[model samples]
Target: DVVGLDGAWVNDFAKQGAIADLSALMTEHDYDDSQLASQVEVDGSTYMVPAVNFVYPLYTNDALLADAGVDAPPSNRTEFADAARAITEAGDAAGTAMPLSLETPSGVQNQVMSWLWASGGSMLKDGKPDLTNDGVTETIEYFDDLYQDGVFAPGAFTMKEQDMVEEFTNGRVGMMVDSLAHLTMIRESNPDLKFSISALPAEDGYDGKRGIPYASWGLGVSESSDHKEEAWKLFEFLMSEDANAELASMAKAFPGNVASVPDFVEDDELMSQAFDIYQAGYPANEFTGLPVAEDLMRQMNEQFQAMLEGDITVDDMLETTQESWSAEF
Candidate 1:
């Protein structure tokens, strides 16, 4: 039902008061959600709903897993590494390529943050920067290790976005992480490939808070909409179990309403596997007072890129990062 670039048509209708309600990600939960903010409250009235529950996970090659003699499914870091190492060996023996790939700067950073979150650290705390903490150190160090271990290609710093998918689909990479909706794309790429998803392996450091970054699209109704009642009705219908099931099929994503998609969930094995991780994966912005998250992401990506290129030292990143956070605070 949504058809314009950047979902602009919906926003237009919202602004015009022509559309009284909208199904958007902006207003799905009550104010109790620590990670989400309300966008529809005006003059003591509410006008939006948000429906997002799944984040992208990496898809792994089953044949590679079998060939490596690794465990069937990894539950923790030890198992994940053992599997990765085995895949590398198997690829080497078969004269194939690496088993992991993703070129997005933010994607890499998000993965790194999950390691940090799993290790119990975050970019901001109470509107302040917390990048110099121990968890961040280990996370970045781990990434550096992966980069240096030949696990990543020599030019990871220069790779393009879709290239990662191409690498995986071409069988040059055994694992690639993207949107949860990628299952459809993956199926289209290799109809018969033995692939499955697993929750991110847990960390060994600290308590391992079990965290992962979340990326989602959502629905929202406009406060200015004239069809508020109709919009609400449509919103409820779209989120209904049956409608959500259909949506899951069309969008290749989990339905926004958690309890309503039982049948769809029961029928989808990969979604089931990914949902287990979704349960443990909390938002990166757990610290309520954390400074503006997007700003920090942009800044950190720039610094991290320099650090990876050997143009900046970890200490330099630390200094700048702390300073940046301090200014923001």
Candidate 2:
């Protein structure tokens, strides 16, 4: 009864024979395979029922931005930096905290990937590391500059995702790149927190486009389960249209069932922004659906965090990561 195995873990679990195939269950329930995100499969077998979908986007505290004289969210990285600087400065004057905050490890990995994707770069070009590309290099450079200039909150190099959300919810940060789950938390905790949402900004001085980092949570039953049939029956019920819509509402996630997808795209402006990014969302895992995909990402993210902390240069980080990914791939 695993509730939420990451989508990236599906492949490794399938390879390890740890999860039962849900393909038959899907057919019996009349679940259209075509409606699912492609990450649900491994070697032509469906191993999990996707329950929640998410995308990472820039969430701004509009009150902080207005206080800093920023009229709108930045369209690109240069403006983002400028706005961050202004907000930081103003926050300083007002005895507040930093304007930008980022998560370490997993969440920071997503943030960095957005920068790469915005510049037409990917960590995996064809199931192998592409860390040495211009997009990756420049993205690291920009983050390094921001860190050195004291743009991001102090200790951001080690903060976890929940830590970042705590900072945002407490009005300590003007902007952050995070998932819809945080939005729900913020609203429930502080309904008056003035905020706006937008796509992640592009690389500094680049006009490529904004990028969204999307991921999912799915249900997987152990292959050794004596009641795999019962487990899959539960999966079917959980992923059913009404159940999915209700779950999405509670979690502030997109329903995995395509038939219930419209429930998330409401008339609200925030929902509109979310829908725009979700429609254009890209998988954070460049080698998604591959064996050890999540492990590879974790390895690279650890190295990337080191780069952010100035423990290693971008070139050295890329070279080391390339070797590790090559060995794994």
Score each candidate by Cα lDDT: 0.53, 0.70
For this target, which candidate reaches the highest lDDT against the unseen true structure? 2
Against the true structure, candidate 1 has what lDDT? 0.53
Tens digit of per-residue lDDT, candidate 1, span 195-278:
777655656533544565444444555455555556556765665667766765566555455544434556677777676666
Candidate of highest TM-score = 2
Worst 10 residues of 1 by lDDT: 93-102
Q: How high is the lDDT of residue 8 in model 1? A: 18
Q: By summed lDDT, which 10 consecutive residues of candidate 2 come out lowest?
A: 93-102
RMSD of 1: 6.3
Model 2 stretches astray by more than 4 angstroms: 1-4, 21-32, 41-46, 93-104, 118-120, 204-211, 225-243, 262-268, 287-298, 309-311
